[model samples]
Target: MNTYLHSVSLDREKCTGCTTCLRHCPTEAIRVKDGCAVINPDRCIDCGECIRVCPQKAKHVVCSKFSDMEKFKWRIALPAPTLYGQFEELDDIDYCLQGLLDMGFDEVYEVSQAAEIVSEYTRLLLKTEGIKKPVISSACPVIARLIALRFPYLKDNLLPLLPPMEIAAKKAVERALKEHPELKREDIGVCFISPCPAKASYVKNGFGDYKSNVDLVVSISDIYFQLINSMKREITPVPFSRSGVIGISWATSGGEATAIFNDKYLAADGIENVIKMLDQIENGMIPQLEFIELNACTGGCVGGVMTVENPFIAKARLQTLRRYLPVSQNFLDENERYVPTDCFFGEVPHYKPISRLSNNIGESMRMMADIQRLREELPGTDCGSCGAPTCRAFAEDVVKGQASLDACIIKTARSKCEGCKNNNEG
Candidate 1:
């Protein structure tokens, strides 16, 4: 059994056992059992979709508090590029970066700089490598996990590179050690300001065999108010910005593909749309495409559940911020040699086909026949009143012995009506 540290969780007290999250979950990781929502850790990609759709606000993402910064002698804050999108009418990105310092972080580093470096390496890899067509971006941890869980066949297509957050953490620690000779390596903590719970889970359980460089994961929503208050009282903004327009544009959809200047690439946002594209890729329908950028959230990081602003509004702010940036001096410089060669991806664990009816081939065949019979008996309406996403899913659950046929409200109502008619005839 593969166990992962998931950041998304449910508070049973606040849960009304509503099926809202069940229908919205892209991977079908959620199920309502015993009048409460249960999350299957193996199937969960931690995209934070459940958090977004939960009506009772029972779903929450586990994140580090401001007090966690006190553990280390030197704390460094690594803010995601999407942080700039949360504030409306903000002209300079420096004000938001400075807010982290005001919020007790000793130093602040932009993850966008690392994004630029990763973009450079990705372009080079695409040019030299002959691995496969439609190289998928591994920048989004949720998408990487989704591939591991549901689209295991596409695992080889995942980009073999560390995400920008990890690179930024590594760079931040290295810079801190070099500038402050007295500080021990253990004394420094690299914390990430995350836009989603998937990134928080990645910080806890790193991708593949690599250990995470980041020590803490802070949700953008957790400190949004504090940062806003801090920005209001900003005395002087930072003199210079480290990231360029290409790097900062990564907050919105299609930004990565645009940054790499890939002409035959497809940029997909939203988990459902990504699944559809992956299905096509699996069927070899898009062999002509060179790359596919998939973000689990609808509008990239701006659509993350932890973000404060609406996705469309945030995307607009990001575009405005991008236009304000000067043309990048090192957009696609061939001579730039700052790429991190040590960064490499390891094999992702294969997911078990849990939806399989049975372990034995003969039993599975029989179960499939039984499931078809049961499906025919039940109403086709996918009202989700039975706590399953669809009528077909409910039938599957019944065959698997996870649910009863009586759990279907439509069936129960019809049975009650039949009983009344029989009594009248008697």
Candidate 2:
């Protein structure tokens, strides 16, 4: 827990005795005991999958909530492009803006503009950087974190660019304050409706130690039901038309690709598919591809763990909406007219990349030897009853200081049986 690089929280009050979180956890980081879920910090990835699956609504992300918007004199909502897909009847982009105003926000902005900026910057980086052949997008923090943890070899290949949310949040705030010279910076709050927990976590942790332009980040799922219920009572849904077809399209796989490139790019979603793609690319099997877009969740942000509506339904709704919308290029010219002069990133903290390689190679080798020694003492049953994938993986966890020897069920049982036999003989 001491070496944990991110934020993690649990609401014991909201937890039920359900084992939903324990079953789906990739790292076996959770355990149910005394009718409550306990997270093993060393093993937890802070993926927010637990928050995604928790049925009791007890799980909560740590951030400024919607009510916090009340403090700002002028507020803007930076709706992730994924957000447009969450609603079926939203036919106009302005309607979505009006809805945010009705909810108490003073203005609304699109993160997709930031995506446009990132896209341009990405092309430049690709052409000049003396790095890997196919550079990965750092937009999805979950995907970035996963690469940092499981596949450090690909670190050089990842494009070192901030995600659209950060870029959009800063641009919106600075533009708003500049447009109204009388407005105080302290009086404005910029909130992003996040599609995933990693986005929220990125803001909370101060991505690379920079104070995020985004003041609040609410999950798309939480906002979905809450917005619907609020709209029912308000008697008027904000009038909405089409967001750019390409921007709204960001909610699904191949979305960014559709906006920018075609065949030279590769788009894949879901952890399984992404991993397979990374493997093939890493092994020099797919060098022909120039760019890669990966979303840790299937169906892109719409398929994030936090969403409530089915991805299928959302995708259908988005497609229906896209048909009625104009292309993104309509707004592109206006965006170019007003150039961002200040470098907001200059004010933020710079982060050093944390490599996963063991610092003490000899020590790690010895630890691995000890782990193998202990694995020989295990049952080799991959039942996951021991809170790990397999005995060998459990051994690696021990080597990594992520789990204790007792965390292995087979080892624990053997120790317990030996103790019982000795006690009885004595």
TM-score of every candidate relative to the true structure: 0.92, 0.81
lDDT per residue as tens, model 2, 319-413: 88778766763343544543243322332222222322256878767877887897887787766555554677667676777667776666778
Candidate with maximal TM-score: 1
Candidate 1, position 348, lDDT: 64
How far does residue 237 in candidate 1 sit from its true spot (Å)?
Answer: 2.4
Q: For model 1, how does the per-residue alpha-carbon lDDT over 168-244 read when each residue is reduced to its tens digit?
A: 89889989999999999899989898899999998888778888999999888888998898885447786556888
Which residue window of length 10 is worst by lDDT in model 1?
329-338
Using lDDT, give the best candidate's number.
Answer: 1
Q: How many backbone clashes are present in model 2?
A: 7
In model 2, what lDDT does residue 254 have?
80
